[model samples]
Target: RRADVFAMDGDTRWPGGCEGRAGVWAQLRSSGDAIGSARAARWPYEATELEVLGEGDRRVVEHGGFLRAVERFDHRAFGLSVAEAGCMDPQQRLLLEAGYVALHGAGARRSALLGSDAGVFVGIERPDWALRNARQPLGSRPSVFSATADTISVAGGRLSFALGLQGPCVSADTACSSGLVVLHSASYAIRGGECGRALVAAVSLKLLPNATLGALFAGMLSADGRCKTFDARANGYVRSEALSAMVLAETRIGGGRLLAASAVRQDGRSASLTAPNGLAQRSLLRACLAQAGEQRGRAHGVEAHGTGTSLGDPVEMRALAGVLGEATRPVQIGSAKASAGHAEPASGTLGVCKAMLQLSASQWLGNARLRRLNPLVAESVPPGRAGGWCFPLQPGQDALSSAGVSAFGYSGTIAHCILGAGGADAAHERGAGARAAVLVRHSFIWYDDVQPLAQHVEAAEGRTALRSPAAGALLALVRDHAIRGRCVFPAAGYLEMARTASCAADALTAAATLRGVRFLRPLLLDAAEGLWIACEVVAASGRVEITSGRDGAEERALHSACELVGALAPAAVSKPALPRLRAIAGSAVCTAALYAAFREAGLEYGPTYQTLGGAWAGDGGSFSVARLRRPPGTSQGVLIHPADLDGALQLTSLLSPSSGGGGGGGGGG
Candidate 1:
């Protein structure tokens, strides 16, 4: 086996922690193979008798091989991963694989899987819980696998559960090509920065009994137990079960890489289940090859389907020959069917695994039954085993193909994956860490019923929303100036400070009751996380006493002295400071409306000390503090700022979290 791609090279093989164990594993696996599958293969291992509970710290296996023991009390030992360990289902297998990667440090299950990022799972779910446990007579379908059969969805959930990723969850129904398509989509997501890493899993479960017989009658199943690709006697396909997984990280490995990929279509131009399209196949091959920089041909080599079907086989060979063109040096080729039968939706994934396996073992395992039929035999399946590929490989070691994954979905979609060597790069751009982005929040809620478009004004680097006004009190002039007229402060009055004072006028009562308002100044909650606010002052001697209202007190009376000055005041008004003093508390009230809008968008706020008369003084009024607390028999111990009580919008007790709900969010007017 070629050990270069994944060998942890003694204390340093994989990107990080996948080493050491690979070494021990390599030795053990070699010994296991040496003993051969002869005796082992005969006694079928039953799931009923054998239980696989993952354990021990030697999870990676030292030098490389199969793990038969449990390390620490990992949730994965229960089945597949931390999420799946509690449940037994087909998804358990995928979870197991995910758990393996995670324990090895190649997994991204914390935030990405469960938080900021999204995920995708591909597979059939295991038998339904109800059906699996029910007594026979009460069961309807006898097997619950039909409805709850696809596990791909659970993969998405498990990944999300482990990683906190939450972008998009999709389960494709592309048949045998589903696994490859899943990988392709995941790669695209990485390139698109939707996620930093993706877990691509493929699996197949035994279908409802007679599903094959039904296919057999439909002519899709080969009556002959064997499958031969590109052979004169080629008939049909043998469906089988297979499971595999490969983690796709956005970063590129240091050594070799899978540069590019292309998927073409046969349109109706190519044959369906019985025929292959050479032209379309070659087009895709060329596209993938073109991505290789200066690489000769489309790939270093190609892996053939070689299902031995008379009609299907030739088209595949012809497709290869067409892609290869006039190159005197023949292209290296082979098949995975030589070992395991075609695994349906997992077929392409299986091929990908074989390609990886070949790169690992440096061996080209030959067809177990076929002698030779194609004229393009420049070298055998193995070049080093029977001493290299001069003829068909006897066994052992040889190079097969650097690229060899192709699949045709019944949906008329065909895809090819280019195999690659491995290593990790720290420089790769990934959208996985902390990201602070601005989201458009409030659009106007119009009384005219017009759709108010949302204006998402982003922070243009170094942008800060300053707290322009926090306290203010409106006074003596017109009670309804805003309804028909606009008011201006006196020449000596600081307009901005007046506005702040006015907004602050209503706050004193609430702040006093709550033992003083403590604004989490400079609140930097993200737009996605929701609304932000802060504070500036404590109005001095502010009292909500009514002095002139004839009825019960609705109009608060902190402006008593100003009113007294006004009444006595033709003379007092002549005083240098009387007009400005009278305007100070009255004007601070006008800032309320403007400040309300800022409260809706999540942002940081800083005090805008805009008083003109002097620096730092409380609202010049006679307000006495009144403490407010949640009344008895109430669960919400909230201190609602009386000034903003009318604008508060409370949410239901329970809410389903959603991003569209706005990250910087809290209900408000």
Candidate 2:
């Protein structure tokens, strides 16, 4: 599962669990052992129980292989207030982070997903943390409503809300099989043409005792602090905490593939509520293979739902052996639970993640904590031949072709997904004609020096320099903030650009401060052409200069210039406080009304430039809330984008003496 992003599990290997998939995989590959231990100190009750019964008496395995600073969320990043963040379920926070990681891994932008037909499907089983927190009294801390912040529906809705996604948002729970079931539903939604893209996540945080105690008393927890999946020592599962997310597009966005997925439900009368039906699982596998357009014998590996239980392990193996026995090669089987423990609703997701890693790695992964296999299942699937870290080399051939991930929930829900390695053909198909989809730039400016903000740094003549193409899309937004019927790129836009450039500087250059910024020429709006912006460090004192002109001119005209600073001297004198500004006693002007008024005055402003609220005085200046009219539920970035800040300046006209009716007039409403 860690290989989904190759993020390292920093908690196990470093100070914080931020190393990502690569780090996590490296640890697993090297140690080849279970990573967690039974906890006595994490919870007071568990500690007291351990103290009374001794350490050996405890059976509950504690897993801390989770993101670092779980409680410390960057509210500013998601545009949430401290109060809102405080009220949010910790699982919600984890899901948000996972969503971001998944999106980034998929090479998709949050801006693109927002307002698009992108659905959110989340699998969540534990609401104990939210319930417990809800019972606490609201003292001096921020108050949280249990119905909104802690609900399971909010888990999926939170993601959709935060990203401005307009597609269907659903939360599903089918006990341990929830994760795979959610994926199943998402795949169908894609097939049914409900959404173009989908975000699927499984988040579980073990913070409350009731949820754990219930499982423990039900004899579902292992007597030892290990998930010995498929081993004769198998007894029960180890509970785990995981927040995993994946972005699913109809077509592959990256190297991974979702060949097919299938979900099935068994009748309740067939067995006990917790019993797993081998017949159902076998049938589910068959259906899955068919959906994948693969034969029963084609898959090279299987990521099993091996929870290390005496009853469940054999049943699952039988299903696998029966369905995949016809394969030319042994269907390599493994369980993520063997290394990371069972993440309940997230178990299926982890299985899929591991399968993707194996397909990409072109090798069969070894089973951890597996020694002697269950006797009943051994005949159909041999212990040694079943699967391991086998690098089978067929003379010159390198890697296996395909693998399948299986998950069977106690709710009698079965889900299976097939994954295939992205071959040269697949890559070629993905990349075919991708250039044609790129935005057509009609500008005369050549894009030779154009670079992304992240890759703009270049050292030349003892100075760090950057060349950026004026993006037409960004300029469209900037063109909206106007003064006197003229479109001028805002100084704030340049400052923002400088700040972004400063991020590429070395540690010695603490910050880049601009001074005496002057705008020599206005960048008029051009439908077919865009300006080219450039920045360079000029002096040793962290002074960075910026200029904008023609794209390909050898010596283009400069539009603006300013000095940059890394640090500023502390001020010795305090500035005098100004009188508080008051809202004008008049009807407020809506953005549309203001724009119409501007049009009548021969000063037309679009959505980006129509920032005026209402005049506060007879002089024509007012300060109103300057908010971007983004799609409903879209989260704002930490710093306001340049276009937004510039748009606010449009309100000054109402207070200026140049206004037709002086400052006292109401907004041309």
Candidate 3:
């Protein structure tokens, strides 16, 4: 498949610990070497399992891929309450995370997805959350419905709802082949013009104790805690946890392509229901090749559904040998399951992701845990090419143009997909410029240690809501900024609030200029208790009003109002042209020292109020740069932050040194 955008989160040694497709791809450059004990000691259930299984058993070791930040969900990012998020499954949480990343990777704008015809197809098989909830005593807490967030159907529907997608939302389960099946379904929907874009996701989380025991009893789990794909030492597969997602759009839409998908089912019967049928796999491969409109020789490689099982590995290889034997080149072959462990329902998506990475990196990944090739697979190996996973590419090697991904469900259902090069640039190349953007480094600086503020914009009527918790903790500087013996929110705070709201609603290329401002009432400190501050876009004239009060159906006091001028303007480049400007003494002091100065001046500036930097008086006026710093648990966006403007405005009072007592209060507009 042409990977216009993909996202993955699994174990890896990347700088950020493999949170995205790039992270997974970087880890795939070499054989997976991150295998380790699953840390049974951390949990009583796993520890008990280990104790019962004994040291000699690989099940005791229980190695598999686990995510590092499973508990760290940004509930506010998805607009879910803490209670709602707690009741939700981690699998659903991960799907939301990965789906959003994939959409952004595909250059799909957030506004477009809202109320747009974008289908969502997700693969999910585990019901660990539901099982765990069932074991708990049904206490006073209300029962959580299986269809709410625990059901597989909600896995896709939740993402669609969160992003306001109106297309078909389906969750598929075909055992290990579920991932490919979901992806194949999404492709058909796109080709059939059912939706303009499709979000396909596969997620697997092994969280319950009973599931491990089931796999152990089923003889499907690796006793040695490794997936030795294509190796003689292969015994069984190791279960892993992962989230893989992709964004698909029709090639005619001018983005990427998921070339072709061919799914087949064993009509009669196999050696057993779980046993894979080689002939069925071969037929599926041929059908996939034909659907891709290419002969065996035209293919570049095959990402086999090699789970390292004693019986399954050989069956998959024999099927590949029979189908790819006629290819012109020694077709490269590999499996991500060897490195990342088998992600069950998500493994098929992981394999396709690996194929895309291989095409982009122009190198076939070496299968991990492969020391000795199985006799059956070795006998079918063509001359010149090593029987095991192919070696890494040397310099100047051409990248593979077409590849095949095969996933066989334990239920005797086989699915194979053929993907060819849709673009010269791989996933990395497509996002290189964005990945290297300076905004990546600076965009997060505006948000402090608080829940990010959500922006709601109705551009049709030129209205937006930038609602957030008030900066009560930032009353340090403004502690002395009072009018009539009452602390008043600084005028600059209003400006920053208005500008930020306007910017969020306007095009990213443009900024807002505040004018026609008026202050209706002083924002008293005590009046803000149990209240939220909001900046609302009032009209088509670009007017934004900052208000504070209780939630809906309550009167909100109008703290300040301003008319916003929205237009494309060149970035500020010219320095301030003034007669004379001087730096405020001790402006370069450390934060503590600056606070000490404020204390000496009897100006009790809190975190947000202490934004004034060096100040100077010259040419019959005073000037200073207000270095507004974000307060703890508060977020700001405008370069000319309200706090900064207030700090700078304070420079005017410096003209009268006697005003240092915080007594010279005047109107600012």
Candidate 4:
């Protein structure tokens, strides 16, 4: 299911009618397979067909002139050479960050740190830059073809080198499904016990200045961006460029297993080079389903290749409507081409990247544009079905089927694969299976005039603000991301439940003047950023507690927490009713933790140690044994009671350890 990190595919989900049933039946038959040999041939289109809810007739117009569109993220608004050569630069940059986030989420789940990376695998369609670099460097006049592959190799090299990966590096350009194919190679290599993990990148170059405009004139490009698949108005097709990448881990277990995936070749039955072939698509889908088995999520949501051209859309729909009988059919459907245009060589791989978001997000996000499908035709006539051949697939795993990704190349090459959500048990089947907790919350609080207090707070426990439920939930969200990312995280070992604190203008004034704390508004920081901050000492530990987010009597649990180590503060202040009660003795992480988090950041306090000298930051760590410095004629503040004497002695011990004679005698007049 969508929740399984690495699932198996037995019985699978196809569309309906003759097309769907025939395809599925063919797939339910494969042979003995090594760990993941079945994954090698699965096409991107196969996964796309698995759970196709409905079809979206959106034209590739959405991404037209996308080279200059504004970005959706505010954070990335800051200048960062996100794009590469041209229009493709922004798209590639976006894909890189998304891929990074996916991997980061995976690492967080297992408490897996990106200590050092190994290597990366990528798929490049038009390695023009690589060729360009080679041409610029050596002038590609006659014998410069050798640099073509070398230049493209730089794309994959960049990803691995940037992340500091040191393992093997490889790339694939299997036409349209190049992205999934790249993932296929990477996933298998990992499963075959090669590298620890693989970073898969899919990059395609946009049209060069005259090269593209000239291609359109050559009639190779779609005239009006109208990919009318099955419509009579269908012309040719427009080409788009984009870059996408995925981080796949063999040893790492994510939210769900990849289960059974297969992509069979059409042999010679694909009709024409770029011609639409239902039989070829059906053949590949059948092969995948045969290996996957019939499961509820057989055909969940399909990401169709509907380019809105009348001929293309209907032709693809005909294949779809043939499979799903309309009743128990696709629940949701969409198309990335509509969102980002054709993306050419990176098309197949980029589509798969989007699928990851849908599956991983537990939500079905697809193109809902375009007019409804026309209810007609002999092959599409299912007894009773018209809610919408492809509806918006509801978000969630229950609706996910053995996804099918379909890709057709200009060379008459067709590949299809079934991608299903592996069951949860399949993942826990390995390793210790101890769930790890990763937090992403920054609970900072800014105040003025409490510089010393703030310093003391961060020092003792590394905390800056009080605890809140939102902070707790934020930590949970971070954990969720890791679970769904790569699932390669080791059982969590660090209990980093810390808070963040800052000083505002008002509190800065009070602390500088040494005035006591005054009531003021505490600008609570966003509790979503769980302390990634280091504490000067240990105050954060005492105020906040990091547990498993479970509830019971959290005593021993709190005891083990890195943030609950201080209880002395409250204990010390509790003796107010005792008049001049003098000393304090307590055992708790919170008590002494106060001094630890701050003494280094520099906080002042009356000093008396065990007759030994020691300072937190600059103060010497010492123990004192000395007489009290009382007012001349009045013993107003001095209690002098038996307990008070001992308290005074302990206080003195902080400054001096013992009296000169070693005898414990101290009664002053």
Candidate 5:
């Protein structure tokens, strides 16, 4: 369930004026034409009335993919004041709204994301809004929020701040390839332990006059205002206005997984600064296929960066053909630009969304408005190449299990990513034997009789035994709480295990408090194969121990030991007064500084463990506020969340800072 949304000016016959995922899909499924005459009411100046010179010929800028009401936004929904919203760039606004919709589709609500470790990666190029505001009347002062609102650098930060995300926030500008580049960066971040999950978004809006004029002067804009990609009549691309967003995470909750590999490369010293390099593109595609390991040569389709430019299309086709030409079946090649127009920086991300849709539906929407195949493109891939390029003239069904997507920047940066359908869906399509083999290999089914904590538990006499598969959602959550660049199981997780074992052994419905808990060693999780965990509890002595080892190993080393006390009675329950502690504290401690100190001490904490929102230190003691960050819809049926408990334990650093040299020292608990 990868959440995705798109705002485009598509066919009016569809519902909601082609404003959502369904609308874009419908447009592609039907006529596959979203390009149309530019509206006079949307732009500040009438585009159809304006003429521009391209290649010594004057052409009217009459066609584009413009949204019906790009100006509409609910300021209150995002907690922005009207004045601030007014000054905010429409790119920023659209990104925020689109991000919310995407997250919601992935089952992450606004309330569930507060203090999340999810990262934000946005790809945006032009500063049209900023340029427009700079041309205000003489003596006009810019608003205080103008810098933040219009600046492209802060676009990702704004979304992170609004969602209360505590992970990495980055904004990239790489000309038209910005979107794919950010997607590449996000995937690397997740793999490199930067964030547990990420939101990748890209937007393009033709709001200023200079952009259009510059493209026209550079002979980039299509005179006919149509992107005839791969067609003999292709001249250039028509600029489009669109925004697309999707969520990427390690969990299977999303629509699909990034095939084992993706690659990014740069063209050095080409014919021109903006010229496409066939060799560089070929190298990039090879690198991506190499990274895919055994999955290489399995691509069933490709969403090409077909800008409809005569030079670019042929070069890209040659590179693609050289790398993917040997497939057993014809690779269905097409471009969304043929229908939606070129969205510039946002084009790459939009192409990814479309590819995902095609993979999910097992279909390919052919090139729109393509009258004839470009002779150069045809010549690039020789007739003898196994199943050469096949550009569909209409929508058709194809078993697109995996697809490749490409985006190249005029700046010479090139990115390519391979995507496979969701595991369950792909396995299903591969047949029952494949599905069973995958289940046996992973040892976990998404929807099984197993509970969240432990998959199986058995109680005999006073001893309790429990076994849980260390993968899927549990693995995803554990990965978020990385320690020192490694996915180490948190101490709180041990407590959770101890409590669960005690309750099961004692036949108690309520969890028992753990006493004398000790983490003997760190449990490191492997990226390829996570080992299963085994817990043993002695109910009579209230003793519990947990351990894990390589699958089918002879011995399992102890990782934790604890004693579970009986559940507390109603009279024994007590609540501490945080306001009283705050009154006694002397000075306030900056949360950011505290985390920085922790990082310097090699106690790195990700977004889930970054729970100390507010802290204060004094001679008497230290007071702090901690918020729990976890996956959405996972807070119920638990005595205490591991993240919340770990956060509270982190306050120990404030009590004995000199031990770790991490600052915020105090004596009182």
Candidate 6:
């Protein structure tokens, strides 16, 4: 089965706590070491569990993964009552929040999902909160809400209900493979016409001590709480907590797409119930690759299900080597378990997310804590193949186009999925054909007048809207003001736009004072997109709001707002005396040194905004003379020059020179 993943998000509490996809990618690209000492608070009976396992000092199970602020959630925002929210499993809460974020990231709001044929598929184990609730006294039981809140089966239904979705809602539990299994199920449902879109989520939490005790008894957990996958020192996997969600659709929507998926059962013929079968894994990989058809060989790497087990790691490597066969270049393989610990049911989906990020960035992240390779696994593959098996210790560029993700359940269910870059086909589908050219016989017939503001202005009862093309003389000036390596519209430019609108709307020559001015958000200019700006004025209250967005988008973001008091009388236009300016000009501070200090603090000003020609400093306040480097032509129709205003405002830095806090002003004339 195949489907497009529009967006994905998650919250994780591995060695280093992270939230959302960007945070996770940052962690992976940087250290990729989220394994550390387990806290006693996470498992109160740590000592007792170790004693029961008969652990020696050299190999004690004293470490596990954890996160802070586990109990933090906003119940009111989700429309949940206090009592029901209290009884609800944290896994359920995480899925609900992350699902909402994922949908939003996909450019679909919860309102958009209402009554739509969008499915919800969740992969989670039995809730630890339910066990804790069962341990309570019968007399204090809140039976009505507990049934729906604590049950893992209702997790998908709860999300569907919250979004008013009408499509299939299914929850799966297949041990470690649960994440990828749900993903595979969602793809099939979409392909089968069961749902037009789907939200797939997986969550795992190490809340109670019993699960850890059971793992210790089964000899499944690592003693040092580190997953040294494909390494000789590998012993076992470390348990971690994670909640991840992704949105899938039939048509591509600016994200990675699944190429194929295959699942197989190992049966009970293996050496042990939990032991990985090489033959089964090899078959699974081949089946998945076969389903990918011509696109199979495009895969650049594999995200291995490396649990750090001595037997499991070797068997998986052999299966991978067998499937890869002879290749021009060795295929790189790594695992998220090495960096973030085994999130069990959530690990499979986490691997898929990592793969998507790798493809998007065209870079491969190194595995953490893999110091030495296992001799048996190294010997199984060819010399060249073995060399490519090891990933770099730091992030490096690779021509990544596709990736393979594997997840094997301890219960013998195995799943493999292939993901590829979907942008090319999407771009082709969205392509606009060449436009026909017009032929003119005479020069007089082809002549046209250019009226920049006249054609863009739209006037209504309360608002005056203006359109600014992405490319023009005004945008050229805006692009000249770069900050932090990006072309950002200056704060003074917003003030200028607001003032120009105020004068036109209120029938004034010029706005005398702007009160309670607030710069809410910066206007970031994109070369390919034009801007739509609206100035809404409340006549009675004198309130003005300036908002801007992409030309064709419905929603506009507020950039600047203020109260426009009417124009000043002719008598009040006289200049005041500047005694401080005269005194400080004699002992002026160097303008070059001041700009250098600004650069050190990350405020990069371009040639247009660097109009601070002469400056001065003193204890009272500080004074500066600023002038525009070149004349802004009259065709621009600007009431006041933004560059000159901005340069004058920059003089405020001298008031608290030593502080270097980079404070901003609230209002200005």
Best lDDT goes to which candidate? 5
Model 6 alpha-carbon miss at residue 375, Å: 0.8
Which one wins by lDDT: 2 or 5? 5
Supply candidate 6's per-residue lDDT for 286: 80
Q: Which 10-residue window in model 4 sums to the lowest lDDT?
A: 29-38
Candidate 6, after superposition: displacement of residue 139 in Å? 4.3
By summed lDDT, the worst window of 10 consecutive residues in model 1 runs over 446-455
Model 1's TM-score against the true structure: 0.46
Question: How do the residues 40-92 of candidate 2 rate in per-residue lDDT, one tens digit apiece?
Answer: 22344333223334343344534333333557565565677766766677778
Q: Write the per-residue lDDT of candidate 1 for residues 376-413, one digit (tens) a residue.
A: 33222323332122223443554433555677655555
lDDT scores of the candidates, listed in order: 0.38, 0.60, 0.64, 0.38, 0.71, 0.69
Which residue segments of model 2 deviate by more than 4 Å? 1-19, 31-34, 37-41, 45-67, 137-145, 295-297, 381-398, 424-669
lDDT digits (tens) for residues 1-669 of candidate 3: 432322221211111146555677667775645454465311332233343565555453466667555555666777877667767777887787778767766667678889999999998996677766553311213445434858888888899999999998999888888888887788777767788778888888766546666778788888777788888888888777777877777632222434645455552487888888888888887777776665322667788888998888888877787777766566777777788888878888888877776766666776666777788777665666533334233212556777788887886667887766655444334454443111111011111111122222334455678765444334432455654445667777777667657766764632566779888876776465565667888656777788878755488888888887764355643666333332333223244554565555555555555654443343332332334455533323234445556666655553434534232322132
What's the C-alpha lDDT at position 651 in model 1? 15
* lDDT by residue (tens digit), candidate 4, 1-669: 212124211111111110111232232111100111101211121121122222221121111322212132222322323222122222333334444544553452212423444446666665443323321211112332333223555556544544455667776565666655565566566666666666666655442322344444445445555333323444555555454444555443554346356453543654555566765655665665665666633667666655544444555666666664453654455565543456555666545544544554345653423344433322354556753444442223445544556565554555545455554433443223533222232212111111111222222223344222323322322222121122111111112222122221112211111112121211122332332212222332233332222223343222122323322233344333221221231211121443333233332122221111221111231322223333332211111212223223234323222323212222110
**Model 6 Cα shift for residue 586 (angstroms):** 90
lDDT of 1 at 146: 34
**Per-prediction TM-score to the true structure, in the order listed:** 0.46, 0.57, 0.60, 0.44, 0.60, 0.60
What is the lDDT, from 0 to 100, of the residue 363 in candidate 6?
Answer: 85
Off by over 4 Å in 5: 1-17, 39-41, 44-59, 257-259, 424-669
lDDT winner between 1 and 2, please give it: 2
Question: Which residue runs of candidate 4 sit more than 4 Å off their true CA positions?
Answer: 1-102, 108-119, 130-150, 161-168, 207-222, 226-236, 251-260, 264-270, 309-312, 321-327, 360-368, 372-388, 391-398, 421-669
**Candidate 5 TM-score versus the reference:** 0.60
Which regions of candidate 6 are displaced past 4 Å?
A: 1-15, 36-41, 45-61, 258-268, 383-390, 424-669
lDDT of 6 by residue, 1-669 (tens): 344433333233333576655778888877566665544425433323343455452144456666545566666657877667666777777777778766665557667888999999898986777766654421232657877877878899899988899999999888899889988888888888899888889988776666776787788888777888888899888888777888888766545355455454553579888888899998888888777776654457889999999989989988888887454565778898887888888888888888877877788888777677788778668665533454566788888777889989998888888887665443332112412112121111100112222225556777665545544545655665666677777777777666666665655355556889898887777553566555666666778787776765788788888987877577877763456454545466677877777666656777766777766555444334333354533223344556667776777776543445233321111
lDDT of 5 by residue, 251-275 (tens): 6553444544578899887999999
